[model samples]
Target: MMRRERLRTSESPDGRKVATWRLVRSGARILRVQDRADASPAYRWPGREPLPLGAPGLVLFDELAPPDLATVREAFPGCLDLWNAVREDFWHALLDTSDLPASGTKG
Candidate 1:
C-alpha cells in the first residue's frame, strides 16, 4: 500500500538538527515518522520491518540526512506537484479513515 509523507527539521537544545519525515495519509492524519539517523540498535527499527513506514513512498528518502528542497526535487523530480496533491487530498483521506475504530482503549 502507498502512504504519504512530508519533511520536518528542527534544532535541538545543543544546536544540533532534529530531522524527521512525518507520515501523513490523504486526510492529513499524521501517524509517525522516524528520525533521520543511522543506527545499529539491538532491535530493528520501524522502517526496517517487513513493511517499511511509508510503504511505496519509502524510496523518496534514501539519503542519510534530512530532506531539503534540492533533495526533494532530486528524489521526486516534481516535488511541488506531489505537495499540491497532498494539500488537496489530505482532508478527504482523513474523513475516509475516520470510519475505522480508534486504536487505543479509553478505559
Candidate 2:
C-alpha cells in the first residue's frame, strides 16, 4: 500500500507557512497534493501517520519570527487566488503529459 506524508514550508514576504500532503509511491514520484490553509506553527507531527483529510495544512502570516495575520492579509489579500491558479496550472500540466496511463490512473 502507498503512504502519505506531510511536508511543510514557509514563504517569505508574508512568512505564512504552507503545508502540503504528499504521497510517495513505491517509486520516487509524488502522488497527491493536498493543501492545508489553516495550520499553526505550533502544531507538531509524529512523522508516523498520514494527516487526516480535514486537517489544516497551510498557515498565512506576515513574519517568521512573529507571524502577523493582519499584515499577511493586508499584503496578500489575493494570495488564495494566486494559490488556486498555481494549483490549477500544476493539475493541467500533469494532465497534459502523454506518459500518464489511458485509464487516467496517475502514480
Candidate 3:
C-alpha cells in the first residue's frame, strides 16, 4: 500500500490552480513527489477554458480517472527515463489521491 499526502495547494504563476503531492510506498524510504495542474494553458481551444493535461505527475484534471502507465508513456514518448522510474502502484495511488473531491463538494 501507499500513502498520499497533499503537500501544498496554490495558484500557479499563470493563475491556474496547482497542487503538489507526496507518495510513499509502505516500508520504503523512497519518496515520490508529483505536481498537478487543474488545467493546461498550452493546449486550450480559443474561447474555451483549459482542460487537464493528463500527463504523468503533471496535469490532473478533475472528473477524469487517473491515467495508466501506457497512457502516460503515449503522451510523453520522450520521457522514457522518467517513466521507467515510476511504479504502477505509485502512479495509481498518486492520481487516486488527486481525484478526491474538494472538501465541500457534493455529488
**Between prediction 1 and prediction 2, which has the larger lDDT?**
1
Q: Could you give candidate 2's per-residue lDDT for residues 66-100 as a string of tens digits?
A: 22223333444555543444344334443453544
For candidate 3, give the lDDT.
0.38
Q: Candidate 3: which stretches are off by over 4 Å?
A: 1-58, 62-64, 88-107
Query: Which one wins on lDDT?
Result: 3
List lDDT for all candidates, in order.
0.35, 0.34, 0.38
- Assess the local accuracy of residue 40 in candidate 3 as a C-alpha lDDT between 0 and 100: 31
Model 3 C-alpha lDDT per residue in residues 1-107, reported as the tens digit of each score: 21244332332344332333234332111222233432333322122343455443444422223334455457545544444445443455656755556689762
Q: Which candidate is the best by TM-score?
A: 3
Error of 2 at 53 (Å): 21
Give the TM-scores of the predictions, in the order they appear.
Answer: 0.26, 0.24, 0.31
The alpha-carbon root-mean-square deviation between model 1 and the true structure, to one decimal in Å, is 14.3
How high is the lDDT of residue 29 in model 1? Answer: 24
Lowest lDDT 10-residue stretch of candidate 2:
23-32
Model 3: how far is 94 from its true place, Å? 13
Q: Which wins on lDDT, candidate 1 or candidate 3?
A: 3
Which consecutive 10 residues in model 3 have the weakest lDDT in total? 25-34
lDDT of 1: 0.35
